[model samples]
Target: MTSQDRKDGIPAGGAGGEGARVPVTDGLRFAFGTLTVLPVRVTRWDRAAARAGMLCAPAAGLVVGLASAALGGLLLLAGATPLLAAVATVAVPAVLTRGLHLDGLADTADGLGSGRPAEEALRIMKRSDIGPFGVITLLLTLLAQVAAVSGLYGESWARGAVAVAVAAVAARLALTLTCRTGVPPARPDGLGAAVAGTVPVRSAVLAAVLVTALCAAAGGLFGISGSVRHTLAVLAALGAAQLLLRHCVRRFGGVTGDVFGALAETAATVALVVLSLG
Candidate 1:
């Protein structure tokens, strides 16, 4: 059989952009495609799965939207209050990312709260336990988010879902923004260099646009806006995301995965709460 014929459906060679023969496996599936964490027993596949992996960063929002709707449906079925949906809209992300942002939040809080230099703040961020400042900061952020999301749930579900979707995509856009404009990898290579730096600006923009558009579609489909509140909500969340990311890039250099996670969660929460008001 020819080289192409000898291969299964998987691309035979020239997978990762060169003439090299990339491995094929489920791990490669996740890494290469929108499927996060590999399909199964496959992470080392040196092949490309753009149509899938490329979507992973943005698809996160779609997953979140469905997750929120699913959880909300479940709670509603159980005869619980819509307020319980707030848990799905808000808490699931923490569970999804395993509270990575809390780490960033702690790191940010500990860093800024310490009144130390930027380098020292980053160093403290690498610490394990939360300081008093971190503790207070986490509490306040959580309170603000919970209060906002819960309040929104009482009035509208569509806005809450849209918030989740928009915030999710915008957070990645912020990461892309930070990734493109910043110092190089702090170490030889970590997550930043491996993925962030390599992501082309247009690719990042496309991914971001795709996510943001999904949100706008949701809002438009549901007619979820009235008065000037909708515009303000979008502006506020996107604004918060931009300001925070810029601050971090200026202070800490490039963005970390922790920072990205925090950005998405915080922005989504803020949008939901703010927009729901009017």
Candidate 2:
């Protein structure tokens, strides 16, 4: 398979392009194509396109969040158990995204758990086989997501749906933060290198702040739990991302495609857990 078919797929930017602005439409196409299983036509392959995609990553998350909420809402309306509804909500996004993030999460766990040099750890991550660490991490993280969402649904369907959407958006926002300037790629090539340092710190900060505010507002509107709880959920997700950032940098030397996926899953899971508490 070509490099584009890899876990992180192709990097947003390619060689031999600079100083020209990419259109919003191009960015949308790239974000949707790269981040989701949705069929989108992405013709541009340059630094500009990659930058646009990072900026538009939240848009893709918004779409995924809505779908997750809809699935959970349908299950709840159909008289399914809260646990069942939460499971479906959690499972649907994984299916929709083709389990890309989950794969990343597993690979990251295996890599970090290996306790080897950065080079060896990265090689382990590139292997297609799942290790014991990957399996255990997947089980625990997925269980946490299901349990948290189920608890939130037990409180109120509306609250659960809001939590799902907010978590999805927050997860994608983590990607932008990870790609911010000064962040190094784990390898010299591939998805991590292509997009690493592509996001400016200012842009990342602005996007993160806006996404947080939007999620908080959305949670207040749909959160039967409490506006404060919703705000806390967003903060919790951000905190999760921060922790992941520190850990990945210290452990792997920098971010990789797997790191991005790992961050998203971690943030989403923690956000849901926090929201469930409300």
Candidate 3:
């Protein structure tokens, strides 16, 4: 290991470094530091830390979700219209992540819509300027998210809050799955390469199960039907994300940070849509 790696508490030889166990706190820092605009400082950069951070991603999502829900709920309690509450709910995640995922979604849309070779498409994605495809995708995605959240809020404040939280957690769960072993990075460097295939498949699966169960429990605040609805929402969201991941992998030769962002936004949107349905 380099002196820098040692200073960062990373094990030698990258992820294969045996006998190195990262503390939960370091993992949490990694997750929050990279995934959101939170003030946490990440002290590690090795694959071991990445694996642990991905495993803890859902927990970070939970915190973001709760913060989003809180703002929306407070607005409702203050007699704000459901539309406004829904807008706040949709905006909170974007604000927290510094719009990183939305930007990714746009870039990925541009890349996919270019109809060019993988190399050219990736080049398109790297451009700072948003293309027509990216603009349209962003417009449609934000509209759908706001509309779905509004519909849920119309039903009841509690339902809206629960749905928001569940969607956030589901979004991060998708990220965890995307990093599972066998998934390759599209590029030789960048955030995607650092985290790609770092997580064990079994660990990813366990994280998904736990996140889904917790979502179900949150929905159980209403009734058995509520629990079932939330459970299905999580499953459906993950399925949608998985399809996107597969398509991106084929089109780009593997995943990138932009692809990860696209996957997250897709999952969150799908989860909210599913929850809004009867």
Candidate 4:
């Protein structure tokens, strides 16, 4: 695979040149091709395509979230314990994305914890092996996810499933905001450069609003309190992701693929934790 392919699992392609009109299907292809290990082909690599892909990211997350919920629900129907169902819920996203986001999370953690200058820290993150920081962060993150999910499962199957779905969509929504205009790329080449600052600020905000509203509607199945909780969870997740994005920009000079991964995981964790609360 070329560097472009390595950026986000998008196969290197030359379709959709600059000034080419990007169709919605191309956008969907771009989103799934890069964000997940799905079999979609990415025929476009231009800024417009990237913008569309980022906007459609939440839709891709919805599919992933539903898949996660379905597996957990099935396991429960099979007489499995809540803990086992939670594990499956947490594992499905990682498996679907081929652990791309998780790997990025580890790399970002190692880079941030290196205590070195920006350039050196970026080099550290690029190394193949995981450092102590990466190992510890991954351990804590996964454990927290499983624990929170298990708690929700213990409450009720619907609660657990909804939480997983909400968390997944919120995670990708964070990515959309991260790529909004004004965020620069950390490197001249890579996924960051390809997608950084691609989205218009208004478009990104609109996507967030729409997603939050949909999530709130989904939560309405429970009650008024459920709607409020889901709305707050999304807001809190976005706030957390924004904070991380700002810090990473300051520390690394701008956004990177690893930073994107870190933001997604942070948002997901925060959303799940919030949903699991009373």
Model 4, span 240-270: residue lDDT tens: 9999999999999998888888899999999
Q: Please give the CA lDDT of all the candidate structures.
A: 0.53, 0.84, 0.88, 0.89
Off by over 4 Å in 4: 1-4, 8-21
Cα displacement (angstroms), candidate 4, residue 114, comes to: 0.8
lDDT for model 2 comes to 0.84
What's the CA error at residue 167 for candidate 2, in Å?
0.0
Per-model tally of clashing residue pairs? 6, 0, 0, 0
lDDT at 54, model 4: 90
Candidate 1: misplaced stretches above 4 Å? 1-55, 181-183, 186-189, 224-235
Q: Which structure among the candidates has the greatest TM-score?
A: 4
Top lDDT prediction, candidate number: 4
- Model 4 lDDT on a 0 to 1 scale: 0.89
lDDT for 184 (candidate 4): 96
lDDT of 2 at 254: 91
**Clashing residue pairs for model 4:** none
- Candidate 1 residue 94 Cα shift, in angstroms, is 1.4
